[model samples]
Target chain A: MSGNFIVGQYIPGTSPLHKLDPRTKLIMVFAYTIGLFFLPTWLPVLLAGIPLGIAVYASRLPWRYLLLGLRPLWILLVITFLLHLLGGSSTAPPAPEDVWATLGPWTITGTGAATGFTTVLRLAWLFSAASLLTLTTSPMMVTHGLERLLGPLKRWRFPAHELAMMTSIALRFIPTLQEEMDKIIKAQAARGSSWRYGSWTRRAQALVALMVPLLLSALRRADDLAVAMEARGYQGGEGRTAHHPLQMTRIDRWLLIITALAGITIILWRWA
Target chain B: MNGMLTLRDVHFAYADGTPALQGVSLDIPRGGKTAIVGANGAGKSTLFLTLNGTLRPSQGEIKLDGRLMTYGRRDLEQWRRQVGLVFQDPDVQLFSASVEQDISFGPLNMGLTEDEVRRRVEEALIATGTEPLRNRPVHALSYGQKKRVSIAGVYAMQPDVMVLDEPLAWLDPAGQQEILALLAQLHRAGTTLVMAVHQMDVVADWADMVIVLQAGQVIYQGAPQGVLAQQERLLSVGLTPPWPVQVFHDLRLAGLPLEGEPPLTRAALTEQIVRAWPKK
Candidate 1:
């Protein structure tokens, strides 16, 4: 269960990507994902890799680690690719000349193969772009950026600051809870609950045993945390100001412009 | 009695009607090192909670610097700013993703300007010697580091009184010494220090005043030298006397003429034993 948990683990660095304001990264990633869906041709999908490649290089995070972040999604990625490659669900009959390969009564057409290849490429582009944001920016920064972005919605009675606080707290407690869950699992295993090699029903029972204690402890922790927070004078987000408020530097501004321009260019290029 | 914080016959019971504190009253001296000692479920934690206004007493009153505590929204906010509490579990106290952010929470919540909050956060990181881990994720910190960060979080508030619940529990000797040194530093800078601790040696060596709670009541509160001498009372409360005092009692029982108040610490005990070495 713990093996593939890689998304939120931040690797501290002084790289340019790490220094960009989280808002810029967030906006870029959002626009980039939208742009990925609009790419009209397989070549454009492959070309989308150029900016992602630059981002990976600029992040200075090990490319190997970034690829490893995709480990859990490989199965889905492959399934999507194969589904398109086989054209198994397509209703239209394949043209005779357009057939690329034939295997076991399924004819793989040029269009289906192209679609499959581009879809995989597009999926990789989107995943890496989002992971880059998580890798370079601390989760607190992400929350702060989100809160600032959502600040205008305060008029509609939106609880942006509270939601951001929740996200930050959740991110902060993830590892603590993970460590706790590990302890509970080990403890349950010691008490003759075969968590590792049990039959499906037994494993499910072991999970229930583990979850009950974990949940109770989490609640107790939350109670203690509230008292501690109150003692330190936290009433609510109202009237509270950030110590490290988000700042848009020249780099952040330039990156914002460039990303917007690139996104518009991609959409326009697809149409043109 | 004049104190930075004073409670008078304060009573508290849980929602389930478990009495955690019953008619407890005590004074925490300004700029003094105070240790609260108690057996498990003796209401040490509850008493600390009352001191900071985290838990309102059911029937009694608490005063901060002679001002009566009121649980109004603004009053409670002001009261919390004056008295900071650090929980026993650092994991529970640290809610921000990184050390710097966690330290900033208190100052930010105080409605300080961004610049002032930043300054306080920086000062706290330096005071706790956590500047190295400033940007490090909270979970990446070791247990001792998390404890320091938790202290830093409260310290950033610049409160007059710092109340800690079992600050020394679960720390190694070196970690305990580090925390004691930090507390001493804070005390020297004029912060009132109140901690509930289990180590009698620590209480004897570090605390100027000791308060012992038993069964939701204050059984003994006095200077360390005076409190350690009441071995039977502490024993009846399920607390062990400092080892030096215990050894002194055993020697006294064996007919040694060593006198002049049982030594509160090992060094004092060793000195007394050496001076009174048998001259036969």
Candidate 2:
């Protein structure tokens, strides 16, 4: 199985960002997201975009991967932009005599346009920051970071172990599922199931036919996983110890402090 | 002497009323390599499952080390640990996130100490020659490697007898030889082996005993030579003799002097053919 293809696919490199501890990357990502949300003006948006762009470049990942990650949310971006353009009239008019032109002869106005542009910029910043984090850090590292961050919660009866297990499994199988999908598609194609000449509903039904086998195979894989886990002596997440320990280095600490300061600065500027 | 494994008049049908196995009876002595040969849908896999207590027979009893096994859930769990079953599909057998964890699964379920489990994991990896693949993800290994890992997973449990279902299926010639050699080595080391296979060559050359299943019934069970000698009986069930046996039969038809039955291995066949040839 081509097990390396999935969302959050880490590009292995020797970049400084890649060397940072996973905990640092996790905290930085959270800080960067919060800062993006609080940025009130285009100035902050442009400035925030700088670190994200540098991070992406330094990680040496293809730019198209970042764009691909946003493909699913493209419709949402467009919807928000259109809504902001139409909803501006409820607040204030830009001009009285030229109101119709400013509002685009219907409901779109100057305020709506501004809001739409800001919303798009904010969405871009959030996605870019997230993509950078994923590209820079391996999934195992991310899971390790999560385990560390959630370690204290274990005292409160929280399922830190189970949650970490789920994360690792998701990381492990997402690529497997994709590879299965590709194989199923190839099999269907071999059987003369073509999507090219089908009606809209027919195409949808064909997709359903394709998905049934994939889902059934996934269920079988899950059963095998349960059996394998049981055979290995995994007894419900108790008394298991990790082989690799998580340690935070000096670069990790510095990165965490810088990201935290950036977050505070964004919040203060927004409130002021 | 008590047999290590015994099945008496075992009958099984699927939920949909498909009769998979009917009145199957066999006794597997400890520390011998036994091969079960049959066509697809001939109940070989069903028989393997019965050994491990995965599928209980409708009628008949399965006993391991003279102890009869019941179909109850508690008993089934205990019986399963005593018999390791390596499934035909490596993909199904290996579902762990990592190879080491997969191998340690059975030992852990048996409640071995952590250190013991680790030691067994290391030993199993070495036994299967997959020690370097310990850290590799289960899904990342090749099909042959995955098969070895699956075998290692079962081996780690330290079962007295190992049941393999079509161990050579989908493997290349080199892989087949490697696995066949490994099975022979295990048998020599006194690990009982019960393998289901379709390859007559392997059954003739490697198995100490051959059991032929046709339409879910064992028609013949004995040494490989006696089974091969029943040409018409084997032909009735859509089975052919091994290549050497077929060649021997042809040589006999050509009026060659032969003292006894033809051999199964290449070296034996060549030696017999040279001996039969007229002195020049």
Candidate 3:
């Protein structure tokens, strides 16, 4: 239930990155991620890390939060690095030509270790850049940007408003659901339902007992919310206006221009 | 005056063929505070659900203001709007993200404008004394605070009659006093109140009328004093009289000349004790 667990977790600050329009941030994140994919060498990857470092600094979010966001991908990073290191040079022993160093009892080669380090560094840059985008944008604002960016699909009867509303509800309920899960866990602990020292089947049974109540409560909440929505005169997406409109300011334009230039420069410097 | 609610020959059973309410009939007068006292599983909650049209009886009619409430979509919605029900668990009643949003839910459903909804939210929060908790998260509140928020959520709807199920359960002494005072205030404001309570002292001091339910039937219905005097009937229905009534009974057993009627309030009990003191 900690609020930090949510995606698009905005740290409240008066920094310029926080003030940029959500649309600009969303576009910049997409462009930056694609630009990272095309960097083929360690020099470009390290160069790309500079803008990401600036974004992290400008957002005023603590470095620890960005690292926490990468916790889920740590195992994948390890696997990729190990695979590159072990497979980068798969051949018969080179006739003492490729071996770079020899000690009294061991030999050091050139190919594998460098490739592994470069791959790990590139992956780290990719994750940190993605995390920076979420740390600076609120979920609602991100959804608003999505609605605006998807506005052209309205001519094809895509139901942009409904989609946006659905996204907003999903975003709003993530923390609520996590809070409920925590309460359920505590309630089960009070009941002496042991999640430790149990066989797989017993643990599964205990989990079912805990999950049933939470699911029932969630369903009841959903029913109540539907009734509440109807009572509040929330008819389907029609004739409703937002309380806070998403407006682009001068800072947003500057941020967008800077991000676009960075992305174009990275691509040109690498491939052009 | 016609009663606010009238049930005649109402019969209900669960889908598993267990009879919850059988031949239950009662009348609750308008502008009167009524307490429905019963032991657990004695059909008090089932009866409240019936009143709000959530459960329709198998063989009876419910009349509100002389109009029969049929089990239909539109009629049920109207009935629900007229009789706001506060559930036993505050968690179930309050599902909104914020207290203000939860309180404004019922008013908003009634098709009030944004300004009207805001006004009612403010008024309900002030009425329940939960104005300061307007922006707090619902799950972060304590049990007693959540109970008050639930009541405020119902109050925002401005129902003619408020039906509360076990309103005082799980509350400490101060919480109980606050809820009792809130009920009294609501009653004074001309809102008909029907509550299911287990505490006999609350019934003695606050209820104008008392209904005792045993095995899903109306076993007793009269003024609070009258009901408290019927010790045999109360005991049969698994209910005990208030403490003052017990003291009055003990005095009667001690050969004191009792007054015309039993006392139902602290002041009345004290005055009766003073008057019944033997001449020295």
Give the alpha-carbon lDDT of every model.
Answer: 0.87, 0.79, 0.78
Backbone clashes in model 3, listed as residue pairs? A231-B108, A231-B109, A232-B108, A232-B109
lDDT of 2 by residue, A1-272 (tens): 56435555677788878887888888878878777777776666777888888778877778888888887778999998888777663655556642445434566566667767888888977877787787887766787788888889999999877788778777678667888888888888898775555788878877988889999999988877765454433555554545346778987787778887777776777688
- Per-residue alpha-carbon lDDT of candidate 3 for residues A1-272, written as tens digits (9 for 90 to 100): 47446543655677778887878888887887788777776677678778788888888888788888788878998888766555545566644665666555444456655666677778788777766766776655677788888878988998886687678666556666778878888888888875554898888888888788888977877776554444333455543433235788987788788878887887787776
Q: What fraction of the correct interface contacts does each predicted structure contain?
A: 0.92, 0.21, 0.11
| Candidate 3 regions with alpha-carbon error over 4 angstroms | A1-58, A89-193, A198-272, B70-77
- The most accurate candidate by DockQ is 1
By the DockQ metric, which is better: model 1 or model 2? 1
lDDT over C-alpha atoms for residue A217 of model 2: 93
The CAPRI quality class of candidate 2 comes to acceptable
lDDT of each residue in B1-280, candidate 1, tens digit only: 4598988998999999999998988999988889999999999888877877889889899989899989998888889899999989888888887788889899989899989998898999999999999988788789999999999999999999999999988999999999999999999999999999998999999999999898899887889988887788778889999999999999888877787988988889999888778741
Model 2 Cα lDDT, one tens digit per residue, B122-191: 9999988999999788878999999999999989888888889999999999999999888877777778
How well does model 3 score by local distance difference test?
0.78
Looking at candidate 1, what TM-score does chain B attain? 0.97
Instruction: Report how far off residue A85 is in candidate 1 (Å).
Output: 2.1
lDDT of 1 by residue, A1-272 (tens): 43455774777889999998889999999999999999877998898899899999999888897788887779989999888888733678877898888998778888887888888888988988988899898887899899888989988999998899899898878778998998888887787886567699988887788889999999999888888888888898876876466889998998889988888787678778
Q: How does candidate 1 score on lDDT?
A: 0.87
What lDDT score goes with residue B58 in model 3? 91
